[model samples]
Target: METVSGHRPTIIDVAKRAGVSKSTAARALAGASNISDSAREQVLRAADALGYTRNALAVGMRSGRSGMLGLVLPDIANPFWGEVARGAQDRAADADTSILIFSSNRCARKELMHLSTLMRARVDGAIINSVADSLDDLDRFGLPCILIGSSAERFPDTCSVGSDIVQGVGLGMDYLRSMGHERPALIVGQPTRLARARFLRVVHEHCVEHDIDPAVLLIENADYTVEGGRFAMQRLLARNHGLLCVFAANDLMALGAMSAVREAGLRCPEDVSILGFDGIQAGAFAWPGLTTIEKPARQIGAQAVAWLLDGNADAKPGTRVHLPCRLIERGSLANLCDASARRVGSVKG
Candidate 1:
């Protein structure tokens, strides 16, 4: 074999130099399951001599198993999904696999196109956290898929992993009630899917049980942004029900609500307590800090990949794995009833 130093060679170059069929060369390069040791060694030696690296793109086109798991998410700018991606990558590495990512930014069309791309790439599996209305668009793809932060009701045969959002939201309200905040408002994002709807429903149920007027504290449905949070909070505050606190569906809105509180001449925890969902890092740095339910973003990512590796994606569409959440207390919450202060006074005495 004539060798050109410092120049890359193709798979055909490796096959010719290795004295093996192109198919044999391809399988060895792809690290397929059933290749004989002798052929693999020859392919490796020839590949090295020819300065060849496997063209994963070409290999993916020819073979159904690209050894890649594609992760499709809505709004990559959100820190929560970033943690999810990190967890997915870690789990994929543990399984000797790689990941591909596409962000839809909450657009249904973009999400559909990205899924199509993943299919064309021949990815072995996919982990999708779509903002689409339902799994109807997804059902047509016919690929091994796991939906994250989405339900499996329509497609009862696909694997899914998500937070126990109902329980998580309920836990947040329970904390507020315990803290002596009688009139609490909800700042929820526009309901795009089941997850958001369940969160709103759970919060409402808790409000009703506690003798709180559900009408006075209904969620301020708006965009899930800092500005949207501020707007929703402004409207909630105008009602003048002596609302002592507000619970945002996620941390971004929580931060926004905090901003609105300050802008409206109220000190957080003094005039109004604030609570956010999603244990995002930003919550810790916000002025006065934030009390929130810690969403298992990273764990969701890890668990999704684990489920895929465990062959759960192939079982049925509606299979779901709901992970739990915990509460994080911080300066943003102050007991309007002075219960926390009284306890501290008793300790000092």
Candidate 2:
């Protein structure tokens, strides 16, 4: 067939070539299940042959949906967040929808700006893992939204999907105690951050349960980064805190602390044992495999999108979902009961 004179190919051109009505071509192209598979395939083949392209804007206008969702993340560069984004993208693709991802770079202003942009783009909903944004900011986003990560607990009356931090904290504390590390040093963020505060609270509770004195517990405030952990470890070493076991807030900090131990002319699990949270893949391949409580990175992302797209009745405002975390035992932590114990580890370590 010769090209249509003086015009681009349209659904009519495709329908004519496929020997089907225009409405049938439209339904087939839209992936309407009412059409038979054979008909859909035929229309698709004709459209491909004719080089037909969908005007997504027009389609969205007709359907009153943009077929896109917004994802606002604090830091996209982090590997944990990357896994979450991948999970969300995968789930969105399942529903024939796309995701518009924006990184706030841990800035409240930037997060609010991204939300505004998402609104301007007419996204169906948003999934936010904000760092500095307040609950008011989320309310101002004025869209169906689901909070992600530990901070979700800080905001009341909202739908959220996050890892069970309390469960994870207990798991970490229990494992450390089981390893015979009672006075393990804690490396975490400032006391104000809800996640860190929550973690510390659980640690205190665990101490009480195990008949340990919480006041003598070693603690070092660190950023959630390798450099931060390194500096914090260095500071703790300076104090001569007799570090035996150190548990960091995340894998990055734990990895950093490991390097610090070496710099101080000490050996890991020999002079000091280290435990980390966040079972990032790098922990598995570290020099000493790091035992950690693995956060549900991908699950939270997928579940958030699922709740948003599925419109489940129970996924109402104020609904909070906490997926469980698991412990990945590796070589980083030392077993004090072992015959080869290098040193007698104590609680104040």
Candidate 3:
């Protein structure tokens, strides 16, 4: 079991040390179902003792798998997506697979290009976040693909994972209404984004069910960026100064809206209340901690990787998994139902 000079211990070394054949060592290390428990234990102990590591490239070549997964995101700069990437990376590492990440910058052409590049690279599978509207081209990629943060209905044959945007929006609206803010406006993301459409639809349905005034149900489209959020908030304020509360689709936009509120000589939770989505870490440190519907971005990312690794083997085509969102109460929202001096404080600058 002695290794050659300057050479790494190989499967042969593990086999000789464990008194098993090379094939047996490989099967034991791979945790193949056919390997006996006693033999597998012996091989594992010998490999640990000899410090033997299987060459992943060689293993992939034999198995016809690259042992790599691809992840495509709309914007890596967004902290929400950063958390997703972290989760995916951790999960991939656990399975002894590497990940190649591509940021599409929310461009359809770039997304397609990235997918093609991944295909050429021979990635075993892929997980796409916010896939483009039309998925006809994705069908030919010849890879096991999973979609995140987008509707499964749009891509019926692909496995999809994401938060229930409609439910998340409803939760935000109900919380705002409970706080006595009946006239709340929504700062939405681009119309091309599926989450945006789902959020708006749910908001409108909630309004209809509650008989809310149509005039107070204001909606403005943003680019899902901090700057975009600020611009959308400015527009909403200019159009309607009477809005007591505002909800932004994501935390970045919500933070931007808070900046705009301050520039307008208004105080959050005092002159106006603010609510946000995505539950990013930065939101917790905002001047008045942001009230938000917390989407488990990391968990979603991890689960997406798991689904891809499992190859959706037993699941039917077009399996959709929707993670629940929770409402996190923070300093940014004010209760309008409170009739004390604070209630007046909430209305005045």
Q: Please report the candidate that would top lDDT against the real structure.
A: 3
Model 2 C-alpha lDDT versus the unseen true structure:
0.84
Candidates in order, TM-scores: namely: 0.84, 0.91, 0.85
Q: Point out the worst 10-residue segment of candidate 3 by lDDT.
A: 340-349
lDDT of 1: 0.80
- For all candidates in order, the CA lDDT equals 0.80, 0.84, 0.85
Better of 1 and 3 by lDDT: 3
lDDT of 3 by residue, 59-151 (tens): 777888988999999899999999999999999999988999999998888998999998877889888964566777775778788888864
Using TM-score as the measure, the top candidate is 2
Residue 252 accuracy (lDDT) in model 1: 88
Report lDDT (Cα) of residue 288, candidate 2.
Answer: 77
lDDT of 1 by residue, 271-304 (tens): 7778998899999999888889998999999998
**Could you give candidate 2's per-residue lDDT for residues 51-129 as a string of tens digits?**
8888876887789778999999988877788889989999999998899999998788898889899887778899998
Residue pairs with backbone atoms closer than 3 Å in model 1 (clashes): 156-317, 156-318, 157-316, 157-317, 157-318, 158-316, 158-317
Candidate 2 backbone collisions, by pair: 158-318, 183-347, 243-349, 244-349
